[model samples]
Target chain A: MFSQAKHSSGSGKTREIKEWVRKFASVPEDFAILVTELKCTEPGCPPLETIVALLGSENRKYQQKVHLSIEQIGEIDAKKISEQLQRQLENKEESVERHNEH
Target chain B: MSTSNNKVPVTVLTGFLGSGKTTLLNRILTENHGKRIAVIENEFGEIGIDNALVVSAEEEIFEMNNGCICCTVRGDLIRILGNLMKRRDKFDYILVETTGLADPAPVAQTFFVDDEIQDALELDGIVTLVDTKHVLMHLDSSSECKEQVAFADVILLNKTDLVSEAEIDQLEIRIRSMNAMAKIYRTKDAAIDMESILNIKGFDLEHALAVKPTFLQPDYPFEWAGVFEIDNSHLKITLSEGPDPSMSVSLLNIGEASAEDVTALLDQAVKTFSDKNISLSPGGSIDSTGKLYKLELAQTGSKTFYVKPKKAGKYVLFTQHKPEEFSMTIERNEIEIDAIFSTNYEASHTHDSEVSSVGITSPGDLDEKKFNEWLSKLLREQGTDIFRMKGVLSLAGKSERFVFQGVHMLFDGRPDKPWADEERSNQIVFIGRNLNRKMLVEGFQSCLKKNRQLSIR
Candidate 1:
C-alpha cells in the first residue's frame, strides 16, 4: 500500500530507513522468511532490491517494508525481482521519452 | 566439584619422521636417569617398536604389544592410563608418544574428556622433535608439518650433527615464527638432561624468544612470488617466501570443475603420501618446517579443495597429485618461481588505523574516529604482528559497550552489550604479532572520559 512518492522523501527517507535498519538489526530473525520466500503481490511492487537488502541483513532484524534502488535489485537472483525491475525501468524510460516528445 | 588427590602429569611427545622422536623416547626411558616413567608409543605400521627396547609386552589397544610400555590405545588410551595409575608406585611420570602422523589434539582431548583420568592426570607439555636436516624438506612438501609445530611446547631440533651450521640456524628461526612458546633445544643423538626435559609445564610460553629461523630481524621483512602453470591442462600455482619469522602460507584454487573430480585427485594424493616407494618420506614421518609444499584443487562445481599446509613456508596449489602436476624448489633469501598465472587477492577494504587499543588515552586528545581508523589499518597491514585482539569499547556518549575481536585484518562485527558499571573506559587485550604494546595501551586510554557526544558511526 506504500506509494513511491512517499518512500522517496529526502531526510524523511533517511529517518525511515534508519528506523527500519535499527528494527531490522534488532529482530533479524523476522527478516529470514521474507528473504527466503520473496514474491510480488501487486502488479507493481518495488523490484528485488528489498530482498537483496534483507539477505544482506541476515544478521539483523526487520519489522517494515523496504524500498531499494535498481542496481541493488538487479543483484538479486529472483525471477520475480528481475521481471519487476525490468518493467519498472522500462516504464520510467517510456515516461522520459514521452516528455521529450512533448 | 570433586578435588582429587595427586594429579598425575601427562607429557605428549610428537614430531615428524627422522626428527629423532624415537631417539628422544629411548633417551627419556633409559636415561631420565632414575625417574620411573611409563612410555606409550603409537606406530603406523605392523613392524612394531625396534626389537631392541621392548621391556615387557602385554595386551595392546592397537596391534603391537612389546615389553617396554608399548600398547596401542585404540579404544583404550584412558583405560590403559587408569590401569597404569593404579600402579602409580611403579612410575614417576607418563610420556605418551604418538605416531609422527598422529595429531596431538586427540591425545590431549583424552585427558580433558575422561572424568577419572581428568582428576588423576595433568597435561605437562607437548614436546615436538625436529630433524634439523630434513625439517626444511618436510616443511616444503607436507601440509601437516606446521600443525605439528604449532602445537609444540618444547621443540627438540635433533640431528644437529647432520645439517650444516647455516641450515641449523635457518631451521631454528623457522620454528620460532610458527610457535613462540616452545623452548628450542639443539641436540644430537637426541641427548638432553632428563630432568630438564620431563615434568616441565609448557603452556603460555611466548614464541617471541623461541628461535628466529626465517626472519631474523624483528621487522619480519620478506617478499612472496606467486606462479601458476598448466601442464596437459592441469593447473599448478606456487608461492615462495622467507624461512625467517616461520611463516605458513595457504593456497586455495577456485575453479568451475566438479567436487567429484577434485575428490578423486585428493584420494590419489593421499595414497601417494602413504605409498612406501614413490613417497620420499615415510608414511606419517612428514614434518613441514621452513620449506615449500604443494596442495592442489581442480574445482568441481562451485566448491573446490581448500587444503593449505598449516605452516607458512613455501606452498604450491595444484589441480592434480601426479608429479607432472607439481614441482618445487627453495633457497635462503630467494623464492624460486618455476611455474606459470597467479595474482594476489587484491584487498577490497583497507583498515583505517595504524595504532591499536593499547593506547586510547594521550594528551593529544585523540577521539573515537581516530582510534577506529588506527585499528582498521592494523587489520589491513598483512605483516601486522598480532596474536589476539579483544576488548569492550564505549560509544562516545552511549551507555552500551561495543565488543571488538580481531586477528590481523580478519576482524568484523562490533556487537554491543549493555555497560555493567559506570566505568567510561574500554579494555582490550592484544597478544603476539609485531605491535607497539605501550603505544597500544596509550591509544586505548585516550578514549576514556570523553565529555563530547560522538557518534560511533
Candidate 2:
C-alpha cells in the first residue's frame, strides 16, 4: 500500500529531511540540500548508501554519505551527517584563507 | 559512462491546453502492460488518478543558487523523484505530466542538474501533445508552447478529426519547420503505440544524431515555384480570394529554368521574405523579377497584376500559397499557359521568429582542444539563450565518438562506444533563441580537421 500518510505535495518526508539537514547543519535558507540513495550494483562501487549534500548559494558543495537507507535513517544519522558536512565546509573555508595568506 | 540497465525510464508529457495529455495518461494507465508505471500528475494541481500509484504535486521551480541565471530546475520534480526512489520497487516506469503553458526547461533541467536522478532514472524522452485545431493560436502567441515543441523528442499532433486534412498538413509543415528531429505522430484521440512514445531513449546521442538528410535542407519562402519561358512582354498574373483575403509572393528572373538552379537559390530567396511587402491593386503594373510583392485582392473578385520582367529569358515565379489555393495562373497575351517546370515547396513557418533550430551535420573529425575552447566560450556568452542541444561528434585522432548533450550551461559528455565499422561524422542541433546559424556552423567548421563537406540548416 502506498503511504498516503498526511502528505502536502513535497511537504512530506522530503521537506522534513531537508528541514532536518538545515536545522542540524545550521545552514542558511539559500543552501540547497540534495538527498538521495545510491544503490551500488557493481564491484568496488560504494554499497547501498544515503547521500546528503549541501550546495551553497555561492557555488559551494559539501556532501556526506552513510551506509543506510531512508527508512533506517534516524535523527542521530541526520545530526552526524550534518556535522560532518558542516566540518567539510569549515575546512574548505579555512584552506581558502590559508591560500589567501600565502 | 552511466549504465541504464536498472534506472527507471521517465517520460515527461508536455502539451498545450486541451491537447489530450490527460486522455493519453488515462489510456496508458488502463492498458494492461504487465509493468508497474508510476504517475506524477499536476493535472491542474491534482487529478483523480485511481488504481495507479499517483503523486499529486505542484510545479516548484528552484533556481540553483549558483550565480548562473539559466541554471534553474523544477524543485518539485527533484523532491518527488527523490522520494519515489526510496520506494523504487513500487514502479517500473515513471510518467511526469506537466501543465500546459509551463516552461519545460526547468523540468528538463531537473534531470540534467541532479546527479542522483541521472543515476536512478533515465530521461527517456520529452513527449509533447498538440491539439491540431488549436495549436496554431498557442504557437503564435505562447513562448512556452514554442519551447515545448522545440524540446520535444516525440510530438503527438493529436485530435486530427477536429481539423481538416489540409489544416493538418499545414500544422505538420509548421511543426516540422520548428523541429526537424522529433518523431511526429498524428492520431484522432491520442491513439498511438505505447512503444512509439515510451522507452524511446531519445536522450541517447547515437540515436539522436542520426538526423535525417532533410534536416539541414533550406526551407524556401515560396510554397510553389514555376519556371516559365518568357519574353520582354508583360505577363498577367491573376488570382481569386479563397480563404485569406490577400496573398504575398516573390518573383525571380533566375537566368536558368532548371530545378537545380531553383534549389540552389533556396537559401538566397529566403532573404526576400524579410523585406517590406509592396501591395498592388487590380490592373497594377509592377516589377517583381527580383523582389517580393503582394496581390491585394480583398472584396475585389478576380484581380489581375501585370509582371514586366526587367529582362526576359527564363524566370522562376514563386507563390506564397499553393497556386491551386486561389486558382492562380500566368497569362502571356490571352491564353493561360502552364509552367515548363513547377513544384510545390513546404512552408517553414516559425511561430516565434526569435527561437529556431540549427542543424549541422558534417563529415570530418574535429580538433578536440579547439572544439572544447570554442564550445566553452560560446556557452559562456550565450548559454542563457541556448535551451537544449544534443550531438554525436567525431574528434580527430580518436577512435570512439564524443557523445554529448546540454541543458542551458550544464553539459555531460564522454567518449562513448567505439565506432567499429560505421563512418564517423558530426551531427548536432541547437534549439534555442537568436541562434546564429552562420556563426555556429563557422565555429564548428574551425574545429574540423580536414574542413571538408560541411552542411547546415
Candidate 3:
C-alpha cells in the first residue's frame, strides 16, 4: 500500500534531481540545498517560481529559479538549473583567480 | 591605541525595574569624586529625569531598539565612546546606565570585544542593583534578572529597609547560588561606599582571580569525556559521534605505566583541565603509520586520526571538551574503544541555554605557533557563535604573562606584569552558543609545549 502511494506522489524524483544537480554543479557537500516555492502578486513578477538555493561556504549563496511550481519541476529543469549554477561557480572561481593574480 | 594608563575606566550599571539603579547613578554622578564623569543612560521615558548630569542616550538606545541592546547597540556604543574620547579632557570616567530589563553581557562585552573601545576605555566593572523586596519575584518570573545577577561584579541589594533582615539573608543566599563570584552588599535606597564600585577592575584577570578563585570554572556539563589506553605501535583513532564536528583529543605518553599510574595521570589531567592555573603540556612525538589524517568534520559524520607510537608503552587518549551539537564515540579500527574513564550526563538547570560559558585552565606554558594556528582556525570557523573569550596564558620563552581577550573575531593581548610570586597558568573562558567543549579543550591541549623534556633534544 505504501509503495503504491509513494509511486503516485513521485516522492523519490526530487531527491534524485537534487543529487544530480548537486553533483553536476560540484556544490560542496556541506552546503545546504533548499528547494523553495516562491509566490509573488506583483505585476511582471513570476507568479510562481521554484528556487533552488545552495547555501555554500562563507555564507555564500547560489540560487537558480524556474518560473514554475515545485511540483512541476522535473529532470530537465534540474539540468538547466545545475548548468546555470555551474556557470556561476566557474565565473566566481575565475574572478577569484583574477583577484589573486594581481 | 591609547596607553593603558590613559584609558578611561567605563562602568556598566544594570538593574531590574525599580531596583534603585537611578538612585545609585545619581550618587555616582552628583558625588564629589574630584573627577568628571560622562553618563550614558538607556531609559524608556524622558532622559534627564535623574539630574542635570544625565546625558541624552536616546540616539544610542533608539538605534539599538530592534530588540536586543547588547548586540544591536554595540556599534552605537562604539561610536558614542569614540566621540566621547574626542572630548577626553571633559571626563575622566564614563558610566553607561542600561535599562531595567537589559542583559549586561553585551554591555560588559563591549569593553572586552571592541578594539577602538578597548583602546580608549577600560571596563571598570558591572554594578547590578537589586531591590530586596521584589527581586525574588522578578528572579522567579524573569530570566533577565537572573542574567543581570550572573554577570555582576558588584550586586547592590537595595531597599533593605523594605524587607526584614531574615528576608535579606534568604535573598542573599539565593543570589549567591546563582552567582558565587559577585560581591553582594546590602544597602538602603542603593547607598554604598564610593570605593566599592569605583576603579574596580572586575574584568582584569588578576583582580578577577583574586576576587573569585573559581571564576574560571563554568558549571557546564561535559558532553563527552573518556580515557583510552593505546597499546598498538600503529593505531587509528576515529570519532564516529560527538557534540560538534571538531573535538579536542590529547595524547599523553604514560610510558610503561601501571593501571594505577594511568588513573593518577587521568586524575591529574582532569585537574589540569579544570584548574584555571594549569594547562596540559602537549604530548610526545608520534610516528605516522600512514598518510597524515586531518581531524575535521567529526561532528556531522566521522573523522579519523592515524597514530604511530614512537615506542609502545601506554598512551592515554581522552576527550574532555563539551560537545556543542551531538553525542560522540571514539573508535579504533571500527571497534568501539571503551573509555577507561568517562562521564555521561545531562545538564539539570541552565540560566540561558542559548549562551553558555566554558572555562579551561592549564598550568603549563603553550607552544606559541601551535596555539596561534589553532585559535585562528577556531575563531575563523566559530567566531560568530563565540560571543566573548578571555584568557591569561603562559607562553613558552616568555616570563611575562600574556593576557588575551576577544569579542567574536576581534582579539587583543599584551604582556602583563611579569610572573611575580603567583604561579603562571593559562586560564581562559569562552561564552557563546553551540560551543564544543571537548573540541576546544583538546585543541588547547594540543598547543601545550610538547613534553618539554622530549622536545629539548
Best by lDDT: 2
| Chain B TM-score against the true chain B, candidate 1 | 0.43
Poorly placed runs, candidate 2 (over 4 Å): A1-32, A35-102, B1-4, B43-49, B65-69, B210-217, B220-352, B420-423
Lowest summed lDDT across 10 adjacent residues in model 3 chain B is found at B61-70
Candidate 1, B108-146: lDDT as tens digits: 544432234444676667788888877776765664565
lDDT of 2 by residue, B1-457 (tens): 2235687888999998799999998878877676688898884734445678998657865553222223566666776787788898888999999999888888877775444566677788899999999998898899899889988888999999999999998788677767767889999899998988888888755565654523534565668888877787778988887667877777776757788888766655666766788887788776755577877878657888887777777877777789889988889888899988888886444334667778888888888888887786676678778877878888889898877777676565767788777778998888888889889988999989885766667
Name the lDDT value of residue A64 in candidate 3: 69
Question: What is the per-candidate TM-score for chain B?
Answer: 0.43, 0.73, 0.57
- Order the candidates by TM-score, highest first: 2, 3, 1
Q: Distance (Å) between predicted and true CA of B167, model 1?
A: 0.7
- Name the regions of candidate 1 deviating beyond 4 angstroms: A1-102, B1-5, B44-75, B204-217, B220-457
Worst 10 residues of 1 chain B by lDDT: B63-72
TM-score of chain A of each: 0.20, 0.70, 0.70
lDDT of 3: 0.59
Residue-level lDDT tens digits of model 3 in B1-457? 2225687988888899899887888787667777677888774623343434445443322111101111222434554565677687787888888888886655665554323445557888889999998887788778678778767778999999998998887777566655545678999978888779988777664553446423222333233444456666455554456544444444565544345555445444444445332221222222422111224543445544565665664555544454334344445666765656555333334334344556677777898878887886676567657655667788889999877655554455666778887866787777566767778888888988854211000
Error of 3 at B6 (Å): 3.0
DockQ for each model: 0.01, 0.05, 0.01
Among these predicted structures, which one has the highest DockQ?
2
Specify the CAPRI tier of model 3: incorrect
